[model samples]
Target: MGRSRVALKFNLGRGVLLAPLIFLTIFYFYPLVSILSVSLFPAGRIDLSGFSEIATSAYYHRIVWFTIRQAIISTVLTILLALPCAYLFARYRFPGRSILLALTTLPFVLPPVVVAIAFTSLIGRGGLLNRLLMSQLGLSSPPLQFEQTFAIIIIVHVFYNFSIALRMMTGFWMNQSRRIEEAARVMGAHGWRLWWTIYLPILRPVIAASGILVFIFTFTSFGVILILGGVRFATIEVEIYRQTTSIFNLPLAAALSLLQIAIMTAMMLAYTRLQRNLPLELQATRHTLQNLSTRRAYTLIILLVSFIAMMIFTPLLALVVRSFMSSTSGTFSLRFYKMLTVNTRSSILFVPPVDAIINSVKFAFITTLLASVLGMMAAYLLARRGVFFARWIDPLFMLPLATSAVTLGFGFIIALDEPPLNLRTSPMLIPIAHTLVALPFVVRSLLPALRRIPPNIPEAARMLGASPVSVWWLVELPLMLRSLVVGAVFAFTISMGEFGASLFIARPETPTLPVAIFRLFSRPGAESAGQALALSVILMGVSFVSFLVIERLRTPGTGEF
Candidate 1:
């Protein structure tokens, strides 16, 4: 009878795992299968025309080459630029370190569209600097001329991904035994010599993980390229968006998406494997941190910190400045912000701009709930021991992250039209779509926390007359609360700023903030641009609050993300 009961309990545990699996199957794989079906076998017949065109066309070859070339450049430059700064963060106990680190990370979470808006306010033809130059130098035309340039694209890409390199490397570096640096110095090794022999090998795994993750992010960049790079530059993601919307070529769009997925999947798989090898041991950062006593060290810290602030914060500052500047004059005004409440568009479907904020908040709450619940379940499943499918299952949760948001959005439109899942038109699909994108992040945030909980704690509770459910509720849940809140905050932030998928699926009347800002920018006028900037500022503020929460709660230098 005891054997039968154990067997029954085992079956029940296994049965519980099916919840997340079923959700994944229904939402993730099914949409992907729809894309695959449409791309390869459109109109109930096999179709290779799109693939053939891609292979034969020189234009596409340029697009493909440019995408690869730019992503490579961005990743290499981000690492080169961020590594030294990360060294400071890893080694120093400095003033405002927590706030500075939080701000540095703030960019990575800000929507790409917001980043683009911020840059436009800083350097675009009608930007603050241009206007200042025009007034001071008596110039009729903007002198910066930085618009749509290759250099600007690279600059923004580096800006967006710099935090990933900084945070990841700093976290890994903090845990390294300081004795290694000491021993290397004792051998008369200095600077590059020390790096080559000691630091390079020690930091290689983290560098690889950071580089590959940033590479994937840059490779699939859509919003920055679309807004700042303009029509001249197009990544695969941008091209996918173009093909689907402007060209109305579903097959071609699907083909580009497939090509993108193939590349991203290979990179994500490499990252996952690398992540598995990253040191999981948590060491207190205080042991490695030191006071900066040397004048030279202080000078370097000040210079680097200033540069980071200039790079990361200036654009956002300019965004705020631009949003307040009156459209008709250079004087400050709140008209643009007030314009959010006014419907300037001459259409029945257009709602007040403020509704977008309300919708975003509402959808974000739903997404936070759904994603947190599913992510916790998924994390638990992945954290389980002795499962044969563990290796494959971990990557499956991550595939959504690797997949293009454009493709995912398009897949939803086509795949969810039938009964029992005919949610293509429903507002609930917005949160559901958001849940898919946010799930990976939510899972990643929780997994580290979950794994850190010792098995004996729960076992001890059970041994002390606690039921299985009670053990989890009373003992395990409290330990996980911080991580769970972090994950939920991630979900809320990502959902609030989500642009790509929301662009494709968001209803005309119920646009999210990013979608609303994008729509506003599509029209040409000072009023439109000002309102867009204003909305972007609001969105950035939301991200800032979320960042503060993460900075407060996250285990310093030990975050899995």
Candidate 2:
């Protein structure tokens, strides 16, 4: 009876793998195969003709170089800028620490429109800072124009990815045993010497893990580059978009997509390997946290807090203020909010922003449900030691995240071209695309919680005559409630903010909020800008709500999240 029960549990864990595998095969792998077929194997014949064109083209080479170069620069800058704050977070406990830590996850959920509008409100030509400078100095031209520059792109990439480094490093640092540090101090090793000798080596794994995540994000980055980069710069993602939309070269677009996938898959394999080597030994971090011991310590804490506040929160505040202010009268008003309800011109694409909000919420609900179910199952399956295939399958699940949504969308167009699979025009395609994008995040968030569960408890429950279902539902589910909420919140917010794939898949009349914001921002005139800012503010509110949920429910010492 006992041996049979153990077999049942193993079978249950192995069975959990089937859902994620099937979902990936249909939505992820099938789309890739279809695009490759259409692009390189048209009429069942191999085609290197398109390859020659891209190879000989100087512009394509520059794009490939630019993609890798920017990602490397962005990853390095984010690590440098975030490490001090990570140390402060790991070593010290202070007022507003919870809130500050929560802020780290906010950027991941926020729409690109909000970040773009926030930066514009703070530093653009007519931005508050530039306005103040121009008025004080009586200058004819605005001094702070960063609309299409390389520096601004780097800054935004840093702004978006800084949290990845801080969160991962802080978590890893917190869980570390400080025996080495204590011994080093006793031997008179101090400051830079101590850090260079002991700390850097210990942190090498997590640093590489977080750096790879940032690199992958910036490597295939689409929305940020398109919104801020202009014609001066283009990544591989942007080049694919232009080739598909402007040049109508599907074959070249497919080739680029394949290249991105190959590189990203290799990097993801490395990340997963590093993740396994990461220390999982949990200890109470409160015991490790120190109070302000010296004047210099207090100064360092204050400086770190201030920098985080300025870098992360100031632009959001600026965006909120800008949204409320009227463009024409330059006074506090609700004109832009009112503009969302009006469609006087009766344009075919002019769905009211209100409807866009409704559409986003509706689709987000479906995405949250689907992604949570698949992600939770995948996490649970991997947490089981009996499942050997989980090792290879785990990294494969992350490929959806590494590949650009543009490539995925292109794949969808080619793959679902037949009847019954003809989901290309269906409204359900919106949520389907969103679920593909949001699934990896859900899996990442919940996997830690699943792994943190003690093995002894399950064995005890089984001995007490509890079935595997009872052991999970009555015991494990409650323990995982917080992580479950975090995962769902991430899925919902990601779906709400998704742009690149949504732009490709969403019908003109059924636009999502991000799509609407892009439309409004693209047009000239103060009214359009005002409307875009207002819509951006709405999206920002959703991100804040996600942040609060995560902050309230977070349990540390689980993993290097």
Candidate 3:
């Protein structure tokens, strides 16, 4: 009887594991299969025409090469910028270090559209410096045209990806013992010699991992290229968007989407293998903070300060300054902001900006809740490592994220819109799509937190005559809350600025903020575009403040939950 009960329990656990697998097969794989089916077997015949088109097209090849070239440049630049800064943040502690670190990380949480908008505000023709130059020096022509250039795209990619390198590498750096640095210092090594000999060698693997991750992200980038490069520069994603929606060529679009998936899958497979070997143990160093007194030290500090100031402050000031300036007058005015927030239109379909804001907030809330709960379940199930179906189930949730937005959007349109259930027009689909992508992040984020919880704590609680619920509430809930909140914030932020899926799933009647911004920017004039820029700032500001509050709550030296 006891054996039968154990078998029953095992079966029940197996069923629980299959829950997400079922969801994955239905929502994730089915949509992909549907796309492939439609593409390859359209008109009831298998066809290689789509693939042939991609193979023969020089335009497609050029776009692919351009994207790879730009992504490589951005990745290299980001690593160069991140390595020294990450080393400083991890190995040293000076006055205002924490604040500086936080500021440096600002670009990471800001939405892609938001970052692109900020860059445009700062560097576009007739922007802050250009206007100033014209006014002061009587210059008739602007020196730089940031829009529709490859360089601008690369700059935007670097701005967004630089922090990933810093954060990941810094975590690796923090785990290293100070004895290595100390020994190097004792051996007549100072400044560059010490970092080159002792630190850089040890940090290679971490730097490589971070670089690979950032490269994949930048390589598959769509938002930065579209807004910054305008119509001239096209990545695979941009091409896919143009081919499918703009030009209405489904075959070529399908081909590009498949090619993107193949490339991304290859990259992801390599990254996952590398990740398995990653050094997960991050030990806290106990060395006292160093003080800067020498002239060399002062020079190094000045350079570091200037770099940070230029990277963080300049772009932000440019964003705000441009937001205040009218593109018409090429002078500062607060009218754009006013036009953004003060919406007087009274139509249910074309709702006000305030309605979009409220819709976005609500969608973010629901998605965050769903992602956190589902992610916790998935993580808990995977942690056990004994379930029969766990191996197959684990990677399924990440499929939505690995697949390109254009493909997923196409998939969602095909799969969900027709059936016993039509979710195409439903506003809930936006949050659902956002949750699908954000769920993987929450799972990844919370897994480490859940692993850190000792098994014995719950057992001890249960041994003391406490029920399972009581044990969970008393011992596990308190410990996991902070990490859960962090994970939820990530979900919320991603949902708030979600574009790819939102483009397809969002209703004409109830558009998310990103969708609204895109709509406004796609029009004919600077008024709408400038207003879009203002909305982008508002979005970035909200996410930034939320992240700041969360970071403050989780400050170093604060006791763990």
Candidate 4:
């Protein structure tokens, strides 16, 4: 009886792994493998010709170089800008500090298409700054020409990723032992010497981790490069899209996808190794914000805060302003918003613009449900099990995160077109793709909460004659509710904003908000452009509300992406 009970428990534990494993295999790995096989076995025989073509081409070489170079520059700039903000957040507290921290994370969740539109309204040829300069200086043409330049790409990348560095570094800094700094001070180290010797060395691992994450994100950039860079610039992601959609060259697209996967895998491995080497530090006993005691400190704090507020809000503000202002009338009105509900006979979209919001909400709701369940299972398998397989399974869950969504979307187009697995035209594909992107976040959030539950508590419940399900319901569920809510919110917001994958799979009649916005922006008309901005604002509002609710419900000291 004892042996039978032990075997039953073991099987139950392993059973939780099955759902996520099967889901990833059929939806994620199968699609990727299909793409690779098509590239290598073009004529039903193995060939290296596709890769050879990419190797010998100078155009491809420049693209590869540009991708790395831009990512490096973006990473460096983001870190430099984020360090001061990280220091401020770690060492001081001010009024509305929590609110400010929450706001800083807004850009991170906004769709790339929304971000591109926001920046264009801020600095593009007909953008606010350019128009102001042209009118004020009496120039025939707009000045501050930043669009389609390397500078704009770097700027946008920094805007999107600055929060990652700030949050990670600040969280790490707050938990650090202050004893080392005090010891160094007593040994006569001060100012630059103290910082250079003490803080930099300690912060190295976290810095590397943050940099690697940012690099990986920027390396797979799609919407930002395509919309902002225009025809002149093409990252690996942009090229892949072009090869697949415009040029009808699936072999080349497949080759590029393989290369992208290889590079991302290498970076992820480095990140894992560095994470292992990160020094464990005790949580601070108490966290309190310091008041500014010196004039210089007060001045610096005010200036920095103001600048950060401007950087974060200006573009979004421009988007809102442009959405309301009529280009033809040169005045503010509710015309663009009203147009959303009015179906036009000549419009490219088959349905009214507001319908896209309905579609997006439906997709987000389904994705949240699916990701939460799968992620909870994965988290339980990792945190509750003592099995050796859990070690490898943890990283497998993160592989979808590292792979580019554009690449995954492309794979879906090719891989799911025929046979028993044909899901290319299915409405379910959009939610499935979004869930893959959101699963990592769900696992990350739930894993920490699960680990915090002491084993003895569950054992005590069992000793009291409670069944496994009863113990979970009576003891574990309430404790994990906050984390579950956070994960669900993240999944919902990510799905709502997801663009790259949705672009490929979303049917015109049932377009999600991002896809609708992209189509609107691509067309040549002032009304369509204004409608795009209005839709973007709505998308941003949805994400913001979700995040605020998550913030209120989150467990204190739980880290967020």
Instruction: Summarize candidate 2's per-residue lDDT along 417-499 as a digit string, tens digits.
Output: 68768898899999999999999888888888888789998879987988878998999999888988888888898899998
Residue pairs clashing, model 2? none
Better of 2 and 4 by lDDT: 4
RMSD for each of the candidates: 1.8, 1.9, 3.4, 2.0
Give candidate 2 misplaced runs (Cα > 4 Å): 1-7, 280-286
Task: Report every candidate's CA lDDT.
Answer: 0.86, 0.85, 0.73, 0.86
Candidate 1 per-residue lDDT over residues 516-539, each given as its tens digit: 999888888777777888899899
lDDT, candidate 2, equals: 0.85
Least lDDT summed over 10 consecutive residues: which range in candidate 4?
277-286
Q: Please, what are the lDDT tens digits per residue for candidate 3 over residues 403-492? A: 766677888787787876587788777777787878877776666566667788887887687765687688887887777777788789
Better of 2 and 3 by TM-score: 2
Query: Model 4 — TM-score against the truth?
Result: 0.95
Number of clashes recorded per candidate? 0, 0, 1, 0
TM-score of every candidate: 0.96, 0.96, 0.90, 0.95
Q: Order of all candidates by lDDT, from best down to worst?
A: 1, 4, 2, 3
Supply the global lDDT for candidate 4: 0.86
Better structure of 1 and 4 per TM-score: 1
Which digits, one per residue and each the tens of the lDDT, describe model 4 over residues 1-561? Answer: 679769978787767879999999999999999889989987899988879989999999999999999999999999888877887877776766676777777788887889999999988888998989888899999878888888899999999999888877887777676788889999999989987999888788888988998999999999899988989899999999999999988888999999999999888778755643442442444355578888867886787679777888899889989998988876999888998976544756567789999999999999999999999999899786466777667778888878999999998998899998899889999999999999988987887688778899999998888888898899998889899999999999999999999998998789999998998888787888888999999998888788777767776445435
